[model samples]
Target: MIALVRHGETDWNAAHLMQGSSDIPLNDTGRQQARDAGDKLAAERDAGEHAWSAVVSSSAIRARETGELIAEKLGVPFIRVYPQWFEQHFGDAEGVPVEEAMRRWPNRDPEGFENDEQARLRALGALEQVAKDFDGRDVIVVAHGTIIRSALMSLTGRELGFLGNATASRLSQGAEGWTVHTFGGETLEDELGEPAAEIVAEVEPA
Candidate 1:
């Protein structure tokens, strides 16, 4: 089992800005949110949820801090950062408001913006790598919202929207393949849905 968690909020997140690949730090509220999320995860584990062996995170400072806080609560090791888990690169739209960017690029395909397919593939590859590194053990992966969303879509073939700050989505791997248990707190049925490849253009920030 793998628990995919979004990093806590940053100023850019609060402003509805595109923070792809940006190295923004979390605010005080964001820090508290991380701790609260950790507490919740601990409670879930105590209630017989899957036990995690380690906490891994993206290279971004915000993600690293979130993972560290969760590790402290779970009494697990905080593994090194993985650049492969970095958020999708937004190109010229990185710091712009999501609405403004959508207006400028109706299809959300801005110049130099990383395409959804690439992000999805990158996310899948990262998941495989992480699973390999911690073979036979469940782990927590703290990453940005966009990449996490991409992974969920690719794994479950469902149309998922934005993931909330510090929220977790769970996945389990079996002999057949990866199975999505929940997405952004919504429990999913075991049946797989049709693949929804297109990322919603008018959607809000990742």
Candidate 2:
């Protein structure tokens, strides 16, 4: 089983900032959230011991810190960096509040973000790679919310729009291929203000 986790909170996160690839750090609350997530994931590990074959994270500091904490809890060294794990590029709206920016750029597609076709391909590709790369083994990836959602949609052929924060999407490798976890949220759910506050006390079963 491969468990994918979104990174913990950050300054922009608390402020409702877009935070594209701005490289922000976690505030105290964010740190606490990561810790809680880590503990939860650790508990879900096999044999009552949270362990993983490998752990990967985005290059961003926020993601790196989150990956580090999870790796430490799982007793696995942070093993890889995936540039694809970076948050979707929000262009001029990087750190601005979503509503404020949407009002300003009502007609403009945010910068660096892929069009629907691109997002679909990227998301699916990431999911396939992550699910296949660590086939049958429990691997954890700490990434941004948008990235995870895209990947989920890609794997499941669901479509972009719903993935919540501080929540993980699980994928299992099978004879058919990579399969998406139903427990995770989608992007639009975040837009409606759902994911950011959901507390996942435990991730997998320990």
**Candidate with maximal lDDT:** 1
lDDT tens digits, residue span 76-168, model 2: 778887776777777778878977988987874866655555554555556556666676677888888877776655554444454445566
What is every candidate's alpha-carbon RMSD to the true fold? 5.8, 7.2
User: Candidate 1 regions off by >4 Å?
Assistant: 189-206
lDDT of 1: 0.84
| Native-structure RMSD, model 1 | 5.8
**What digit string (tens of lDDT, one per residue) describes model 1 on residues 40-134?**
88888888888888999999999999999999988889988999899999988989999999898888787788998888878888888887898
Please give the TM-score that candidate 2 achieves against the real structure.
Answer: 0.79
Off by over 4 Å in 2: 46-51, 159-164, 185-206
> What TM-score do all the candidates reach, one by one?
0.90, 0.79
lDDT of 1 at 22: 85
